[model samples]
Target: MLKKIDQAALFLEKNQQVFRCPFCHEAMKAKDKTLFCSNRHRFDLSKKGTLYFLKQHVKTEYDQKMFQHRRALILNGMYDPLIALLAEKCQGERVLDVGCGEGSFLHLLEQQATLLPSVGFDLSKEGVYLASDYNQKHFFCVADLTNLPFNKGTFSTILNIFSPSNYQEFARVSQSNGQVIKVVPRSGYLKELRQAFFPEDLAKQHYSNEAVIAKFQETFPKMERKIVTYTFEIPENCQHSLLEMSPLEWSVTKERKEFLQKNLLSRITIDLEVLIGRFSADNMKNM
Candidate 1:
């Protein structure tokens, strides 16, 4: 088997045109195990076959343990229905997952549908590191969403699922015929969990995607919107993982956490809206 660095080197060499230097905005080329721009700003793949586009270490609330829980939930098929919906909307040969936490969604999407050259990047080093353990057919990197390391018109399908987005950067890196599939949580998403933990907190109990939806609609006026809502029964093994997987658990009180951990939730509401649209650089410029 090829060494991890060798695998990443091969990918970078084959797809060098997809990238530009995050710092100087110059085109970059892969040389053996390293990627370097014309100005000699270089990045190397880690031993685990992942690359780093981040200039400095970024501290995020998402740690390795949380990613582990998230990955467990994914592998256990918690997101299969949502993944199927995403697969149907996917088009073109290249897919880029923005804010790809743990890389499970991208990895599973390819598994459930046609194989494509997929790339996933996240701000969390732990998330990217865990992602590299997925199929070698996909590439994972630690990158900033505000300053993506990809060149213009690189990806045909861009996925921003339950994560943050940079619309300007998304428009810049998207192909003319490309589509962006963004999934935002609905008010009912994880309603049970929220109520169990923060019953008195109305703001925490309800979520509105109106502002986010409005912004997306403004950016892509003729976008298609689909609401996918379902309740997934939590398996006995995944109950604890479900509790700890989301950022919601981070702020819960100690008593609530302990109670939820022991009592466990039977199911979770998966309510999300998948917005699909062809990005117009002009529209984004106007915004």
Candidate 2:
């Protein structure tokens, strides 16, 4: 079997047309385990077959451990319904997962549908690094959403799952006829944890995706929305991971964390809105 780096090189060589230099916006070619642009810019793939597109390191609020917990929670089927919905909506020719943390969504999406060329990128190197280990077939990269390192009209589906979005860049990189699927949280999402962590604060206990949904609809006027809401029973071993997986607990007081750490919730609320649509022809024209 080929090493991870070799696999990535082979994939890039065949599909180099999808990529663009982040700095110069020039087309790039893959050779010698590196990507080279016409402007003499080069990006070398890491030993693990991951690429780093950021010029400087970014400090994310979550660390490698948090991502590990997130992956564990996902593997335990916390978001299986959401994943299934996403799989159903994805066109899957050349899919790009923007802000794909740990690459679990992309990996599972491919498993559900026929395998296709897939790429996932995140601003956190830790997250992207963990993502690379999820599947050798998928390309994982540390990249900025605002300055995606891909040519225009490259992907058939763009996934923005519970992550930040750059609609303009998303529209720019997507095929004119392609679809963009975005998942945003609903008010009842993680309400159990929120109620536990922020009992005194009502605002923090509830979420509102109205602003996010409005923005997504504004960008893709023809979008369709699906609400996936359910209660996932937390397994004994996954309790801690579920608690630690989200950023909701980041700012909680030490006493509360310690208490919750000891008394984990029995179930979690998975409330999300999955929006699917195409970037209008006018949007593409503007791009």
Task: Say which candidate scores most in TM-score.
Answer: 2
- lDDT tens string, model 2, 1-287? 78888988988998889899999999999999999899999999998888998888889986899999999888888888888877777744678988888888888788787657889998888888888776677798999988999999888898888888888898889887888888888889888999999999998997687988898888878889898999999989999887788888788999999998888898988888889888778867765
Candidate 1 Cα misplacement greater than 4 A, ranges: 281-287
Q: Which window of 10 residues has the lowest lDDT sum in candidate 2?
A: 85-94
TM-score of the candidate numbered 1?
0.96
Model 1 accuracy (lDDT, Cα):
0.87
| Number of the top lDDT candidate | 1
RMSD of each: 1.4, 1.2
lDDT of 1 at 204: 90
Q: For candidate 1, lDDT tens digit of each residue in 129-214?
A: 99988767779999999999999989888899988878888888888857889999999998999999897898899879899999
Model 2: per-residue Cα lDDT at residue 68: 94
The positional error of residue 205 in candidate 1, measured at the CA in angstroms, is: 0.9
| Residue 207 miss distance in model 2 (angstroms) | 2.2
Backbone clash count, each prediction separately? 0, 0
- Residue 108 of candidate 1: its Cα lDDT? 83
